[model samples]
Target: MGIVSVSMPEDLLEEIDDIVETHDYSGRSELFREAGRKLVQEFREPSLEDRDLVAIVSALFPYDSPAVETKMTELRHTHASAVRSNSHSCICDDQGCVETFIIEGELATVSEFVRDVEATNEDVQVEYSLFPVDSIQRPTL
Candidate 1:
């Protein structure tokens, strides 16, 4: 292995230090190594022959942002077959809007759409999370 130097914000570095201490990590190096490995695995492309996966991608963005609203609508329409359903709600006056996309389709297609949604929202500096779903499907209401 080779040594690599990188920089991060002070707050993030402090959080990493806290995690290292709390989780009994050897140090920043070991923690970062493991993190890098996990990141690589999580981002690897899926193959056509692979089984389709059910996934849920939840994104929270400013409800008042026209661009974000349009992007989400277009995404749902473009992937209607893969997108099982979409549920949206507003948490409160100050919390913006939150939406979840239920997707059931080929692994590669789902992954690609998820990445696109994340990038679009991130361009607006929105926060989001994507997770694999179990066989259970929520009833459309």
Candidate 2:
């Protein structure tokens, strides 16, 4: 490992010293080493920020239509690499209906899939947005 120098405020340094002592670390070097390892692992692993995304799709489709289901299935298959989860709900009326889908995928793939699905279905009016994926902690119910 190469040696590097960084400046920290006195208060932060004191906090680091306290952590080092509490953890029984040999010194600040060991404490920083472990923290760096964890930081690297957190970024390297495919956390929500990397692979998690939510797409909320609002579309108009015929009542009791198979088109929506078919399109969703196609999207799932085509973008299987990015998908983590999905859910669908519908609100129907006489003229047409609005369907909503919550889909999780990589940002690019999910965006592309949404575009393709919208293009393929003429009768359906679709709008989609990506929800932020928080990786700092596990999602709570």
Candidate 3:
């Protein structure tokens, strides 16, 4: 319908192409369109009733960004009560790092913390996305 230009590393583009071929997506545009729709639906600001939901929050940034590590650490500490688990890893292409925080609490808390982290991420030029998911932890018998 519309065209948007995005810059991605060569390897990442190749991987997209591979996924498109393997998964039978119409093309790169169709592949990205699906991803875009999913992101929008998951990341949109939640209504009051949805505030108690749990979700996984993801962030990507250059590993060497001057303030990324510190800022992320600060946010984690600031929201320690809500942030349940965290993980960090180098991206597949090695252009940057990726981090994930599995947060459990009311949606309000999760959304607020994610917004703060995302704003700071913007200052650092980091990419961020959040996906809402059911709380997956199960109780032992």
Candidate 4:
């Protein structure tokens, strides 16, 4: 086995230590190994079929980058059919911005929107979570 070095914020390290104790992990290495496996597995999963899905897409970038924001706006307009709603907020005294898009549509449409947002720019940090709409149980009338 090879050893790798990592650096993290003190607070994050503290949180990892807390988890180590709470979850009975042997150490940080063990916890990190498990987390790595989970992340890899998630990425390796096959894409879902074009089923109904709802997704919340978020993009974070510097507030001064109007180009990035403009690209996101264009993409939003291009995918307007899938976008249900959206919200934008400034963070860290306007140094950065976070834009959230609530989308509901076929899985392919939502996934395309997410891919477009992620490919906006290297500086833009994008994250999204999607859930199948059919998974929700509704009361029978």
Candidate 5:
């Protein structure tokens, strides 16, 4: 690896130091390296409009029921373009239960479908975000 020098603001440097201490990092070099990797990944990720995007739809539901699965399947079929993949998980809660889904599809359609699901299931809390692939710029070595 090539050595490089960087000048950071005093406050920012102090903040970095705090993070290092809190996380028990070996040194600022390690922290900076990880930060750089994330920055590069974010920069290299494609814009949503550039390609078909995958969306992860996470939801919390009041109980585990076949109705939830059926509804989710119907929602996926109705909005196929917005759903490339789907998955569900069960969470046990004192009041009832919670189910989560990770879905993939076109950004706009997926977002709309998520909204629809939320509207249909009043007791379910849904969250979703899109990640575009096939268009993300790969970093060069």
Candidate 6:
């Protein structure tokens, strides 16, 4: 292993520290190493760059954040052709809302939509899974 130096905003570093303490990470270095591995796995998987895809995208955010909701709506419109269906639900305890979309399109378009949702709000938690269109098993008539 080699040593490398990096910088982050103090507030962000503090958040990392909090997680490290809460989760009993050995130290910042160990925490960062694990995070780096997870990120690499997320971006380098399945290699479906040129294929048509079907995806499920979901975002969770505090229910009171209208800005997040509005941004999500704008992105949905911008990618309207890719979106097949959308559903919203409030968590039973009323603390948060989840929005889910079933989207089908080329890999690039689906990835762009998911990236936009992830960038819309730092507080929003976004998750998505993509499957190549040809890989899905279709029912025979």
Ranking by TM-score: 6, 4, 1, 3, 5, 2
Q: What's the lDDT for residue 113 in model 1?
A: 78
lDDT of 6 by residue, 1-141 (tens): 989797766988999999999999999999999998996676556677668889999999998899988988898898899999988888968899999999998766887788899889888889998888889788999
Q: Can you write out model 2's per-residue Cα lDDT over 1-141, one digit (the tens) per residue? A: 899797766877999999999989999999888888985664344543456667776666766678666876787678676655555555544545565556666665566677776775656667776665654468689
lDDT of 4 at 26: 97
Which portions of model 6 miss their true places by more than 4 Å?
Answer: 1-30, 37-41
lDDT of 4 by residue, 22-76 (tens): 9999999999999989866654445545567888999999998989989978988
lDDT of 2 at 30: 93
lDDT of each: 0.75, 0.68, 0.73, 0.85, 0.68, 0.87
Off by over 4 Å in 2: 1-52, 84-90, 93-97, 135-141
**Deviating ranges (above 4 Å) for candidate 5:** 1-51, 93-104, 134-141
Pick out the ten consecutive residues of candidate 6 with the lowest summed lDDT. 40-49
Compare candidates 4 and 6 on lDDT and give the better one. 6
RMSD of each: 5.6, 17.3, 6.0, 5.2, 12.8, 4.1
What's the TM-score of each model vs. the native? 0.61, 0.45, 0.54, 0.65, 0.50, 0.73
- State which candidate has the highest lDDT: 6
Per-residue accuracy of model 3 over 1-141 as CA lDDT, tens digit each: 778998767877999999999999989999999998886665565543464556577787776776887778888899999888888888767778877887777656866877777777553343433444444466899
List candidate 4 segments past 4 Å from native: 1-47, 139-141
Clashes of each: 0, 0, 2, 0, 1, 0
1 versus 5: better lDDT goes to:
1
lDDT of 1 by residue, 1-141 (tens): 899997666877999999999999999999999998886676574432355667777788775877987888988998888898898778788468877888886667777777778777543333333444444479999
Better of 2 and 6 by TM-score: 6
| Comparing 3 and 4 on lDDT, the stronger one | 4
